[model samples]
Target: MSAGTAAAGPHALEELLGDPFDPTNPAGYRAAVDADDAGSVADTATRALDRWGAGAEFVPASLGGRFTAVDELARRFRPAFRRDAGLGLGYGLTSLMAALPVWAAGTGAQRDRLAALLAAGRPVPVAFHELGHGNDLSANALSARPTADGWMLDGTKQVINNAERADAVLVLARTRADDGPERAHTLLLVEDLDDLPARGFARLPRYRTTGLAGCRLAGLRFTGCPVPRSATVGTVGHGVPTALAAFQVSRCVTAAASTSLLEAALDAVLRFAGGRELYGRTVADLPHAQSLLAGAYADLHLAQATATTAARALHLHPAGGARIAAAAKYLVPLLVEDALNDLAVVLGARGYLREGEYAIVGKHLRDAAGVSIGHAGGTSCALTVLGQLPGLRPAADPPDPDLFSGRPLPELDLSRLRLTGPRADPLLAVLTDPTGTGSAAGGAAPRTRELLGGLAAAARTIGIRAAALPAARRGVEADHRALALADEYARLVAAASCLGRYAAGRVDGSPGGLPPGWLDAVLRRVVRRRGRHGEPGSATSDSALLAHAAARTTAGLSLDLDPDRVVRHRPHPPRRPHPSRVLTPTAGGTP
Candidate 1:
């Protein structure tokens, strides 16, 4: 089993929730479409997760909860995200992301208070995104001026999730008047919003969203609101560093969460393709359709490998983690978006529907788009990776095989996270500079070795070109090339991670392991994704892998490194009044 699935082994959430197609539970796929009332739709999932004691999952064992490793944590939360991104965000992820900063720099009292809030199922909103500044944290207009007693905060934060209902707020505000780039903003833990003078604080109206309709994307404005000095997370003017460190961790988890959505989307596509008749047989039997399905399956695993490695770096190699984290955040969403878009073609007209059993597929697509652009977004993450390219050097020692060895992961210490360090990445080093026999991977299949060889060549070429650019020309002229190189490096990391998983028996020669031609299929897709001009190889080999995935998914088996028997799909029973709303019947009999 993968470390993630292994961690979720004893959990009851998956069993109780069952497949999205199940009939008995009203909260399955059928109900998900009908519960589309803007602010109230996500309540069902929120209540379910609360009942499951999911709050405990967000806290660390040392803090009196069950979080052990970042990878395992992502696995535990994937189900919620797969069901509804809105539910994941409004219900938990927002709060979890907010909690990370506190965990990283908070005092013991602050940590204790935050833990208590989580255990009580209280949502803590992180107000880092100022719509006015557009994710430019340093440019935020929200100001906190020191007073005789504490600080008087003024200014507004927009597009914050769960802003109105959160028990406490984590505010990123400017503390210094000087416009200097460093140490201008400070992070404060604002508590007891109810105690704020009614005249000083106000909640703005929630913004309607094109996606995540269930989320309350609202704003908050503070006018000289008083906050205690004890609310300060770390030292004065250190908020920028604290937030960046937290982003490195949260972004990796966010990427991992996106994979779950990809799996669900693929599940929907395979079901449609396997049952629908195209020519003489099921659409899945068609060569082109099968090719699409297998490519997507390979893509999902490749993204998972990269994301899982980045999560592992939280503890194993925290120093070089910033670049890895940015790469995951930048790559996973775009990949899953492509995967979903491909499936949309397979679904044909079904992809356009807004309500029905399969309508959740459309919702998943829209929600996935919002996630990529939300928070750090794709552009921000790409720039972060690009900025690091100029300073990167191959690691002095090769990356440890234990990182992707697919063994049980070690517990992480978030306090060790850094904002900046040497750009030497051991993971990419394994690809760029190979030791004789490739440590622990000496016995890997020849095809797998070929993948490593291709990856090494790509890295060497990218390195030479990236280094050749003068530092002046490297800024804007190199944007396209740098972004392409970042993507190539990410693919190499994914390939290495897959090889490691195979060596440790996580892939274990199963069909899920990119067996033989599957690896070639993945590399071709990667090269094409990088906009490279190359011969498009035959899909004959990948067709078998796609067929395997379709059969397994049809039987309700998971597509991760660890395969498990899953609850088979049960057709939705007749629709009842949505627990949230009573919709008038349409001209058709549906809903």
Candidate 2:
């Protein structure tokens, strides 16, 4: 388990891939493409990863592995995400999703079984969502009928990652068909798919996808499959609660991992822009290019802050953590998609090409699209937020400093995770606390005060709307102001995350923390997104922060804290003038 420490896994994984872009290396973009066609990582990469015990990060320390903290889990998985989205989802996150339920609510034997399998670098597929009822696990059609000695399982699950090759599957089935919504589903730990009797069950064929081509997206169909009663994961008729509870973890991972992928995309574009010449100057010298890079950089930081804080809140604020998780899942991926779109304009044609120079940009963009829309799409998340609006209130105290102090968290109490939490939002507290240390009275930055003011206004607006909406109209009004408040809630939460991180730094009395300018840049973007334009004393600009991010990327370091040093590609030299050379948008600035 020592090797599974926060820094160890990512460091070892990074060493395994080396510099993916190094022309002299075999494990570069070509390798990724080959893996895509084969629908798995290259044998050499897999063998190397297996040897590194990368899977141990999925198991808890008490279970003989090091899955202690959510933040560390996200950090450790960065190398996989940075390398290739298909391989990352196929090889890592999917397995984590499969194991989370057992860890959260499984028996000792179940946890041990999952821990041993993960420690051995084996795959585990979590089959939850059905094609007919996406995100609505309560409507799952799969059935586990009671038998004399066990349950007979029958039905199918679709769009599952690694389903075809999973060593075992965590299945959700309808256990009490005649029961109400809450008692309808049960979670089962089913294995021995390869050994099942003929005609009992079969693995569905893999489904091709537009992105993450290497991922084995497939389905499963069961026909009178018999399994011992021991297969039941938790209390009978509690499957819906268990599944919803587990989502708080998986959704955060999806958002965090996707953000990590976006960082790689941003790096690729930065590498290209730094090297290319536009007219008489480098593309990085163009005002539009600079602004785009700044916006993307700021967006990435905002997302990182949101993800980090929410992951911490899993332990720090267990009461309402599910909503926080939903907000992160809903908001961060969209921000990443938006960031990618802005970068696409900067990359021009390089963004469109699927192969060749800067191909990873296009590949990552496509793969990221699925993540944005796959699990609990934006609309579903909006509904989640909308439903929770009636319970929201300004926090009485400031957000706990531990959430953003960058310190280690205590062991996560998965059992403490709730399906629904009080509407109280601590992030919003940062905006409402008049006497907080960073308030304008304490001489905080003017931009910070203005941003806080905007948040206060937005909160008032949402509170009023949430109060006025009758219970019967909640669903019908969701499309109108309910959805709008949900959007604002997301932005407010993100803004609060940014400010909370900064405030935590102040609480620790740490000198030379994130500069005020960075906070201002983040808040400017937050307010702009909230539809509160032309706020007085808007952030000046993010030019300096953008330059700093570019330098960090050039040095092969991530924008987040304690960045793992990665393989940095040397910038391509400016192209020489030639009669055969074309300067169209499709022809990116340099090779």
Whole-structure CA lDDT of model 1 = 0.72
Q: lDDT of all predictions, in order shown? A: 0.72, 0.76
Question: lDDT per residue, candidate 2, 263-320, as tens digits?
Answer: 8878878778877766656687777787877778778788888888888899989888
Clashes of each: 0, 0
lDDT at position 97, candidate 2:
79
lDDT of 1 by residue, 1-591 (tens): 111222344235666456677644555665666665434454556677766777677777788777778887787777777778877777777888888889888999999998888878888999998876776787888999999889999999999889879879899989998757558889999998888899889999989888888778899899988888999999889898889888987898888888877887787777777666543456676666776777678778777877888888877888878878888888888778887877777777888997655687888888888777767987677666666666566677766666776566766787788766576767656666556227433665566567667776765555566666666544445566666766666666666565455445443335444454544555556655634222233666656667567556555667754444444463333333344554444575322
lDDT of 2: 0.76
Model 1 TM-score on a 0 to 1 scale: 0.89
Shift of residue 341 alpha carbon in model 2, Å = 1.0
Highest-lDDT candidate? 2
Give the deviation of candidate 1 from the true structure as CA RMSD: 6.6
TM-score per candidate, chains pooled:
0.89, 0.92
